[model samples]
Target: MPSTVFDIPTWVNPKVAPDRHVQIAKALYSVPGDLIGQRLSARVDAQTVKLYFRGELIKVHPRIAAGRRQTDPADLPSELTAYAMRDLNTLQRRAESHGTHIGIYTAAVLEHPLPWTKMRQVYRLLGLVRRHGADIVDDACRRSLDAEVVDVGVIDRMLARGATGQQLTLLPPPAPSRFVRSATDFAVRRPS
Candidate 1:
C-alpha cells in the first residue's frame, strides 16, 4: 500500500471565498500598511507557490493560509506595515513550500496627525501633568509620613511656611504622554 499526502488550497487562488478576503483584509490591516490602492496576485505550481505585489513576485510554500488562522486588525497595533510584510512573507513561503498560490494586497500609506494638532495635544497633556503633579507629590508625602493629608492641606502648609511662588513651584508643566492619558482617563473616569 502507498502512503498518501493531502494537498490543500493556497491563499492566492481566485477560488478563495470572498469572506476570506475580508478576513485577509482584517489580518493585513492589523499590520501597518495603507490599504488604499495596492493589488495582490498569487500563482501556484506543483512544487512552488508565487505571490506578486505590484508585479514583483516571490516564491513560497502553498499551505500558509490554509491551516493557519486569520487575525483581526483591531487586535493589533494601528501601525501594522511590518506585521503585514511578515504575514506576506509567511504566506509566500508557505505557497512555495507546498505548491500553492497566495495573493495579498498592498496597503496605502497612513496619514499622520497634523503638526499643530500634535502640538496642541502635547500642550494639553502638559497642562494636565502640571495640575496633577501637586496631587501626586502630596500623596507621596502623605504616604511617606503615614498620614492622610490632602493636597489642599499641603498647599496651605506650603503657603504658611512662607514658600513664595519662586521657592514653591505651584504651576504645572506640560507632559505629552502623561497629559494625553491623564486627560482622556480623567474624562472617562469622571462621575456624571
Candidate 2:
C-alpha cells in the first residue's frame, strides 16, 4: 500500500473592523459583515487571501499593493447601497463610450431625483448591449439618436423591432427642471 503526502499551509486568525474588512500588508480586504466578532483565518497566498469564517471559506481576492484598496459592490451592506450608488462615474463613462444617445440617456436616468431608484433602469438599458452585442447596440443607439428617442422602453422596442433608424414623432419632453433634486427632498417633512 502506498500513500501520498499533501502539504497544507497554515492560516492565522485575525480581528476585522466594524466594516467587516481588514488590511493586510497595506492591502485592504472585505469580509462579510456576519463574520465580524467571530474567529476568522487568513490563508495567505502570493497574490490573494483565502478568508475563512466559522471554518468556512468565504472570499479570495488578488493581493492589493500598498496604498491600494478594493471594494466589491457585492460586499456592500444593504444600508450602504445609497452611499455606494452616489458614485456611478464609471458606469456613466461606460454608457458614454457605448454611444451618444446611450450616454445622454444614462446621464438623464442617473440624474433622476432618486438616482439610486433609477439605477435598475440604467442597468436594464445596459443589459440590451450585453444581449444584442455592443456593435448592434451601438447601431440601435445611433438609430435611437436619429429617432430622438431616449427612453429605455422606446429604445428597447426599436432595437427589438428594427425601427431604430426610422423617425417617428416623439411626445413633447416634460418641462425641464431648473434644478436637480436629491433623495432628501422626498423625505416626509415634519413641521417644527
TM-score of each: 0.22, 0.42
* Candidate 2 residue lDDT tens string, 1-192: 439555455567777876667776677788765666666788875657788877778888777787787677678786564346355776777788877767877887687776777776777888898777767777766676677666778768877766346666789978857696767888998999
lDDT of each: 0.35, 0.72
Cα shift from native, residue 72, model 1 (Å): 15
lDDT computed for candidate 2: 0.72
Evaluated at residue 77, the lDDT of candidate 1 is: 44
Best by TM-score: 2
Steric overlap count per candidate: 29, 1
Name the lDDT of candidate 1.
Answer: 0.35
Summarize candidate 1's per-residue lDDT along 53-150 as a digit string, tens digits. 56665323332343354444443343342233244343333223322111110000011243232322222322332554434333333342344332
Off by over 4 Å in 2: 1-86, 163-192
Cα deviation at 76, candidate 2, in Å, is 5.1
